[model samples]
Target: MQIGITMFATDYAIPPQELAVEAEQRGYESLWFPEHSHIPTSRRSPWPGGPDLPKWYYDTYDPFLALSAAAVVTKTIRLGTGVCLVVQRDPIYCAKEVATLDRLSDGRFLFGIGGGWNAEEMEDHGTVFATRFKLMRERIEAMKEIWARSKPKYAGDLVKFDEMMQWPKPVQKPHPPIIVGGGFPHGARRAIAYSDGWMPIGGRGGDTLAMLPPFRQLLKEAGRPESEVPITIFGVGMDGDALKRARDAGVSRVVFGVPPEARDKVLPLLDKGAALMRDA
Candidate 1:
């Protein structure tokens, strides 16, 4: 399994470019940045992670811009959007950003996407809260059409557009891998239906290791091979047993969540993770 790192990419953290270079130098396979356009201070919707959302969620720099900085600074480490909320953005503009980033990074982009959790946040973007899942699927489908065709158009219940042309087509043939993110079964099913990869938060419901076989079974039942739709589990802890279990479960990648902190604080963790990678 490929081991990597993910961070919130806040203004106070080790900047994305510096972290990318350091991660590459430490033999980390990839560097992932999470995105949240804006955090509403209303505190109406409960945070999925906990009672209080971290300040980094509101302070995050735009993932595309941060990853662009990372791309210019580093050559080998793969770039990723840990969980870009596609439901909250305009797909036409996002398609352009994805294509441009993929081109600039020389086909090194991994598009990890989600429907998001904050109801008020989605509402602020003019997206319906209850129907966000369908909207996300449609947006993803529309973006694929945009990436694959010279004059592309999509007519979905939620997302529709006339035939249009966009430049700087992604270097990755059909566009960057769309790694769908959500909870089990539903998210996994969406991945099988349309996305190129599956990204589930580890321990969201229970043990992530225990869930993979059932996920694979679901793929088999759908006539889709799990191998074709790779799994990348997020929030994996750095440990021998966890790593072993993740590998045994056939995970394509496991990303360790890092705190948005200074270089002095973050680099030591990267060193330890790289050491574990070597030991594993």
Candidate 2:
């Protein structure tokens, strides 16, 4: 089981570069940063976690910029967005950013994305909340074209672009490992459809073990071998039985959540988590 850390890159927390270096030195395999382009004050959408949303949601730094900083400070450790809001951004620009980052990081980039849940936030991006999933799919498809082809063109209900030339193709052949982030079975189906992997958050009320059979079936249905898709659990806390269960369910990676605290306070826990995961 590969161990990694995920944190909200907020202005008040330890800088991303320092956190990345610490994790890399301590034998962590990767560092994941969450994204929230900007939190709207309208409060139209209830917080998914609870009734009240956390303040950090509004203060978080751009995941791409934060991960880029992390990438430069560490070698061998992969950098990724824990769950980038692909439903909110222009796919063409996102493709460029992702490819550039992958090249700069020596192909150590995992693109984890999701159709976010914030309704008003989606509206702010001019994306319909009802069709957000469809938009995300087409956006990812469009981005793949930009990444894999010399002169790419995409025309669909959501994304339509003429043939355009873009340079600095990703160092990873055919682009980076796109890890679809969400709970099953809808997210699992989407992952099988277009992503290289599935990143499901722990404790999302999903039958983690049972999820695999259907997920594998979906992969097979999509004409992709079951072995081709990796399952990674995000925000996993230290629990021996749970880890065993996840491994038994064929989870390939486990990302522990790092508290938004000072470096000294958080780094030790991260180190302990990494050590335990490695031993597990």
Top candidate on lDDT is: 1
* Model 2, span 1-280: residue lDDT tens: 6778998888788999999998888888889998888888888887756788888888889999999998888889999998999999999899999999998899999999999988988898899999999999999999999988989999999899999999789999898999999878888888888888998888775566677787888788789986678888898787767777877777888888877778888877876886677667
Best by TM-score: 1
TM-score of every prediction relative to native: 0.98, 0.96
Give the alpha carbon lDDT tens digit for every residue of 1-280 in model 1. 8988999998799999999999999888888998888888898999888787989998999999999999998888999998889999899999999999998899999999999889988999999999999999999999999999999999999999999899879999888999998778888889888988899998886777777888899889989887789999887767877887788878999999889999999999998899888877
Q: Model 2, clash count?
A: 0
User: Candidate 1, which segments miss by more than 4 Å at Cα?
Assistant: none
Q: Give the TM-score of candidate 1.
A: 0.98
Pairs clashing in candidate 1? none
Clashes of 1: 0
